[model samples]
Target chain A: MKADLVKTLQKKKKQILEIWMEKQLADAGLRDDLISNEELRIQSEELVQALVQSITEKNLGNVESSEFEPVYEILAGISLSRAKQGFSPRETGIYIFSLKDSLLQVIQEEMRDDPAAMYAETIRISKLVDSFGIATFETFIKGREEVIYRQTNEITEISTPVIRVWDGILALPIIGTLDSSRTQVVMENLLQEIVETGSSIAILDISGVPAVDSLVAQHLIKTVSATRLMGAECIISGIRPEIAQTVVHLGIDLSNITTKASLASALRHAFSQLHLEVRKKQKQQ
Target chain B: MEKIPILRMGHFLLVTIQVDLYDRLAVNLEADLVQMVNKTGARGVLIDISAVSIVDSFMGRIIGNIANMSKILDAETVVVGMQPAVAITLVELGLPLQGVFTALNVERGMELLRNRIDLDLNPEDDDDDAISDAD
Candidate 1:
């Protein structure tokens, strides 16, 4: 009886692809901009062929069997590519469910003469397609996470910048929340620049930081300590009024760290520390 | 017996740690450094650890102890040429080595030691000159 169901699906593979494509094309949420109809037809045909070839009599009830490996592989590939191409989860879900609908319709028509046989085959096919839908969602989420991880690394690279503001002064403008990992990057960059430029003073500008909590304050202190260890003075500048209030409210002791209200003041302090005087040249008379 | 050498120039003592310091080596260096400071009556001590890598918590404490011991013996300690990784590790280990002065390199460390000694001796020297003139 199961063999008969597999045979029916195998025979009507072309018909299933046709119905699946029609259903997808008719849907309002179909992303025609992202995927062309011709390419969609090729992907759908590949999935349909793989599914029918894998659905043998013995493994029809077991979607997890090795016989269905090819089908799952093809589904995973399609789902991952769609995710990278910016397909919505809803659209991917509908794509898998629509294929299930097409398969069940074909089975229903072939077993019309025997209602009991049709009911049994329908349950088996539904269960199999549901499992495939789950696999698709899993791969889709994995692909999206890869995209997010890459973007996070890029942001970490670009955000922490160490600028040599003067011959003996390096300025690092931190533009984000201060975390332990970011603190490590910021500290390393500042220390290395200090070594390369022989800078005795470093200015950490935190004006772009949105908020300051105890953890961030701890990171800042750690960075300053590390800089000092490398035989340089670190001055934290661009202290927002709210951050100062929060620090005082939290009772975090920043008395040891030299902080400035703005980068200009930090620069002025650095000059005095280095015994460097930047005077405006006299205008030619 | 492996020993880290302490070189004395004028009123300052320079110790360059060229090997990775183990516990025994660090302890011996600490004892020897303090003894040398007392014996020579040096005004400043500069330690260059640029070649030494891989510092543990014990090493961090040893460095801090050396600075504190020297301070008590009337000598200023300036640690110089600390690698970035070592500095980060020391900070993370919660040993900032407070009261320890630092410099970028040996040249700067030497300059710092000279400047600190000069600052401390300037007022006393003026009094000595006035007394000599009166005599």
Candidate 2:
């Protein structure tokens, strides 16, 4: 009986491919903008061929067996690529479930004369397709996570920029919420720039920072101390009025740190520390 | 006994730590540094630790102690050439070495010491003038 079912699926592989493609294209969730109809047809054909080739009399009841490895591989590749192509989870899921619908419809027609065999074969085919659907979902999620991880790393790399404002002064303008991990990055970059430029003064401008709490205040203090340990003076500038009020209310002691209200003032302080003056040229006319 | 050599340049004492300092070596250096400050009447002490990589809390305290000891002897202590990692570790250990002066390298350290000495001497010159005016 199982052998007949495998033979029946093999004979109707092309029909299953056509029905599956029709169902996917008809679905409201289909993303015609992301994938062309020709490409979708090729992907559906490949998956149908693999599924029919892997369905054998011995393994028809056990889709998890090694015989179905090729089928699962094709499904995983399709799902992962769809994920990368920006397919929604529901769309990718429907692509696999629609194939199951087409396969069951063919099996139903082939076993119409034998009611009990048709029922049993329908359950077997449903279980096999469901397992394939699960595998596809797993790979889809993995692909999406890879994209998210890459974006996170890029944000970290571009966020912290060390700029040399003067010959002996380096400025780092922080523009986000300060966390401990980000603090380490900010600290390392500023310190490395200080060493490379041999700058005697550094200005940490926080004008772009959205807010400041005790934790951020602590990170700022740590960075200042580290710079000081390297024998360079660190001046924190661009203190918004609200941040100052918050610092005062929190009772965080910043007495030792030389903080200015703006980057210009911080630069002025740095210049004075280096005993250098920026004077304008006398009017000659 | 392996001793970290301390070199004297005029009124300044320079000590370059070329090896990882164990507890015993650090303690010995601390004691020896204070004694040298007393013996030479040095106005400033410059310790270059760019080569020293690892620093525990014990090392941090010893550094603090050295700065305090030299300060009591009327000599300033300036630690120079500290690695970035070492500085972060020391700060995390809660030993900022508050009283100790710091410089990026030996050249800056020397310049800092010269400026500090000049600043200190100029006040004494003003005091001397004030006393002469009183007389």
Candidate that would win on lDDT: 1
Check candidate 2 and list the clashing pairs.
Answer: none
Q: Candidate 1: misplaced stretches above 4 Å?
A: A25-36, A80-86, B122-135
lDDT of 2 by residue, A193-251 (tens): 88888988999999988999999999999999999999999999999999999999999
Q: Which model scores highest in DockQ?
A: 1
Error of 2 at A148 (Å): 1.4
The residue-by-residue lDDT of candidate 1 on A54-143, one tens digit each, is 788898888889999999999999998888788887788888989888888898888888899889988988899999999999988887
Task: Write the residue-wise lDDT of candidate 2 on B14-73 in tens digits.
Answer: 999999999999999999999899999998999999899999999999998999998899
TM-score (2 decimals) of chain A in model 2: 0.90
DockQ of each candidate's interface versus the true one?
0.82, 0.74
